[model samples]
Target: MWVKQISVFLENKSGRLAAVARLLADNGFNIRALSIADTSDFGILRLIVNDPARAYQVLKDAGFTVSETEVLAVEVPDRPGGLAGVLDLLHDTGINIEYLYAFVSKSGGNALVLLKVEALERAVEVLGANGIQVQDYHIVHQI
Candidate 1:
């Protein structure tokens, strides 16, 4: 399943990150996952929140340059080369991945990964066909 992800363009300043976090907190948004990529001048903060659409609106209204993208939540095995094996499979299947962030949950033996790929639907189909678990928003949020 596809999930909505929020991406905020933030200045490469210290307080800026805190400001975004505070805004979300005050607005009653629960963050499920987050990844930040930055340069010397600015950064892109990617977030998977419980309410992505609402968070996007709130952030935009708060004057943050924000956008929403469709991403997928994938479950990777916890053992060694687990992620690598998945990547290899996608590569062999001709799928191009844009970016991904992963975290190994304490409750489950598998690792949860959020992936923004070049072809969303095909990746989902390929992963599903190969027995890889694709999670919906509710399942991801619960983690």
Candidate 2:
């Protein structure tokens, strides 16, 4: 399954992050997961929201630098080794993961992984062949 992620380039200044969040809130976007990679002068705000296209548009309209990226959303068991198992499958298939982050369900019984890969199609194929379910964009965006 492919999910759209919004990557926003932000300066290291107060209210910058809040402005972005407020824009999304005003546009009716509910963020599902978020991560920020920071540097001395700037940061990258990576987010997965309910409405990615709209979120991107909102950010763009607000004068924020943004980009849309396709990523994989995978469901793995909450128990130990579940994530490892999935990674092992990908590694065996020679799929290189660029980056990944996790979000847990309310019950803490499941873990959803947001993954960026070098080759999306091949990653999906290999993961699917290994009995790993790849969530559809529809389902992912809704969640």
Candidate 3:
């Protein structure tokens, strides 16, 4: 299943990150997971929130450059080589991973990873066939 991810384009200025956090907090949106990629002048803050629709609207209304994307929340074992196995499965199936970042490993020794691939449907199909646990939004929230 696909999870909604919010991506906010932030200027590389002090307090911008805190402002977003405070806004979300005030709006009663809890951050589930987050990642950021930055340059000298700007950054892309990726987030998984409790309420994506609300978060998107709130960010847009506040004049923050933002967008929503579909990504997978994959469950991987919290052990050595666990990630490699998943990567190998995708690689063997010709799935191109755009980027990935670790999330809180709170699922009883199973780490949740936010993964993005070019071929969404194909990747989902392949991973499903291979018995990989692709987490849905409900499952992600509990984790």
Candidate 4:
């Protein structure tokens, strides 16, 4: 299944990140997971929130550059090499991972990996055929 991810482009300055966080909090958005990639001038703030559409509109109205992407939330084991195993599966299937970020699940048993990959449909199929659990958006939204 696909998960909605919101990406905000932020100027690299103090308090910018805080401002976004405050904005989301003020709007009652629960951040399920987030990752930041930064350079000298700007940064990309990727987020999985309870409400992606609302978050996007709010950020846009606030003058923050934003975009939405479809990513996968995969349930992987919490032990050593858990992630490696998934990577290996993708690699063997020739599915290139664009990027990934992970967080411990709120339920406290498994790790949830947010993955952006080339050939999304194929990746999902491969993961499914291999018995990997790709979480649905409905489940992730409640986290």
Candidate 5:
């Protein structure tokens, strides 16, 4: 299964990030997880929210650049070497991970990892075969 993630492009300046967060909060959207990758000029704010469609539209209406992406939310064991084990499986299967961020699940005991990978279908298959749980979008939304 694939999760819907929103990527918001933010200019590098003071209060830009807070302004975006305030907008989302005022719109009643709950942020499930987020990560930011930045350079000197701009940054990419990747977010898994309760409502992707509304988030995208609100951000666009506010004159922010936003886009949606299909990513995977995987259940990783919340124990030693859990993440390494998952990575090893992907590596052995030749699935390249472009980027990833993680958060502890509020309703579960496992850590949830949001991953962007090349060949999403193959990666899902490999993970499923290896007994890793790839979460559905609906489940993630509820989180």
Candidate 6:
């Protein structure tokens, strides 16, 4: 139904984020998408990588508090309003998106948007009912 995401606690200091990215990059983990929620002290770096298990291990081994979460990945047209259309649909259905980030899909003409919603099951059901496509694990892994 969705992909596993890595949430890394990072300090706001310079090079803290780079250290995490470098660790993943050096481990052959390809970052598909990422988002950062920051405050004055620290940040939560949400990441979708090629290998979630391995990525988690790498980060954990490096002494970082990392957690995995299930997130929805939706494929949309790579044009303007493509994202808006989906958001609008969700809004109209009373679904609230907590956060979202985009990634280039392996599927040529489409883009992947990783979303966190307030209600997981309900959101999926409503999105499907409204003709909005939600990506499964197999589809997301391919890209």
lDDT of each: 0.86, 0.86, 0.88, 0.90, 0.92, 0.85
Off by over 4 Å in 3: none
lDDT measured at residue 78 in model 5 versus the true structure, 0 to 100: 87
RMSD in angstroms, candidate 1? 1.5
lDDT of 2 at 82: 89
Model 1: pairs clashing at backbone N, Cα or C within 3 Å: none
Model 6, TM vs. native: 0.90
Best-matching candidate per TM-score: 5
Q: Judging by lDDT against the true structure, name the best candidate.
A: 5
Show how many residue pairs clash in every candidate, following the order shown.
0, 0, 0, 0, 0, 0
Candidate 1's C-alpha runs over 4 A off are: 104-108
Question: Clash pairs of candidate 5?
Answer: none
- Per-candidate TM equals 0.93, 0.92, 0.94, 0.96, 0.97, 0.90
Distance from true location, Cα of 46 in model 2, Å = 0.8
> Lowest summed lDDT over 10 consecutive residues: which window, candidate 1?
102-111
The predicted structure with the larger TM-score, 3 or 4, is: 4
Q: What is candidate 5's TM-score against the reference?
A: 0.97
Q: Write the per-residue lDDT of candidate 6 for residues 1-143, one digit (tens) a residue.
A: 87899999988999999999898888888888789999999999999887788889999999999999999998777889988888888899888888998866545567778999868888889778877778887667657
Predicted candidate 2 versus true structure: per-residue lDDT over 1-143, tens digit per residue: 58999999999999999999898988888888888989999999999998888888889988999999999988887789989999999988888888898754422356789899979999888888887777789877776
Position 81, candidate 4: lDDT = 95
lDDT per residue, candidate 3, 1-143, as tens digits? 68899999999999999999999999988888999999999999999988798899999999999999999988787899988999999999888899998886556568888998878888878878888888887777555
Query: Is candidate 5 or 6 superior in lDDT?
Result: 5
Q: lDDT of model 4 at residue 39?
A: 95
lDDT accuracy of residue 53 in candidate 1? 82
**Candidate ordering by TM-score (highest first):** 5, 4, 3, 1, 2, 6
Deviation (Å) of 73 in candidate 6? 0.5
Task: Give one digit per residue, the lDDT tens place, for model 5 in 1-143.
Answer: 78999999999999999999999999999989999999999999999998799899999999999999999998998899999999999999888999999854643778899999979999999999999899999999888
Error of 1 at 95 (Å): 1.0
